[model samples]
Target: MTKFGKIIRRLQGDESGAALVEVAITIPLVLLLSAGVFEFSNVLNTRLLLEAGVEDAARYMARCSGDWDTCKGFAQNLAANGAVSSGSARVAGWLPGTVEITKISKDATDTATGVQLYLSTKATVDVVDVSTDYTYQDLGFMSYLGFSNFTLSVSHQERVIGW
Candidate 1:
């Protein structure tokens, strides 16, 4: 064989760069998957925190009495910050104004789905619903997975025992 033919055959038989090429191709995929998992966990954690705040507020309103406006204001503060007074929100970007405190009553013969939520438990009293809508702020990792900033909605309902 000629000199060029020998050189071509030798280069073709060499497998030294094979592992490097494989690693280079797979690194980006691994990184993307890891980032996606981290983003999902962060979003889930925020949702849990928001739900806890709403639950606390609903429980508080279930036993509270007095002025309707005052109770609602206090519930809003509690739902937003986990406190009945003004304080830092449990989740960033959450505000007291975003919290909604609603009272739902059931008639003796009402068959509405909302009122029948506790039918299995035989609860016949009124209910207090504490809810909030929050926009989640991500660390820019979710953009790679085709997800943008999304809204999280959290709510809790408690049976009211106060007249």
Candidate 2:
């Protein structure tokens, strides 16, 4: 056989570097998937924390009838506590101009002595609306993939009870 034919045969039979080539191609894809999973988990955890905080504040407001200022203070405290518990170090703080509280009232009739009478009175309901924005600092890998810092906004509302 000619030298060229022998060289071709040897090259075709050589499988020594096949595993290395496959690993080189798949390693980066595995790493990218792992990073994505990690980032998604972080986002999910932060969202859950925010939801818990909001729910707690709402329940507090519902149980205790208070003025707008008092409810606002409670919401702020809950938001800060949530940030600490979420484990995201990059969260700067809750965004301003997002917290809101509104009061509502409605009039209704009452029945007494087998007669319906207009009470001419209104019942007041206090609604607490809380919204918080949190910033997440992406990992270097994510940044390289064109992802930047993003904000997650969470909001909740509750009506005052036992008022």
Tens digits of per-residue lDDT for model 2, 27-71 = 999998998999888778777876776676666656655665665
Query: What is residue 123's positional error in candidate 2, in angstroms?
Result: 7.5
Model 1 local distance difference test score: 0.84
Compared with the true structure, the alpha-carbon lDDT of candidate 2 equals 0.61
Top-TM-score candidate index:
1
RMSD of each: 3.7, 6.9
Clashing pairs in 2: none
Worst 10 residues of 2 by lDDT: 82-91
Q: Which stretches of candidate 2 lie over 4 Å from their true place?
A: 1-5, 82-125
Whole-model Cα lDDT per candidate?
0.84, 0.61
- What lDDT score is found at residue 159 in candidate 2? 58
- TM-scores for all predictions: 0.81, 0.69
What are the per-residue Cα lDDT tens digits for candidate 1 across 35-105? 88898899999999999889988988898987778988898888888789977779988888898889987
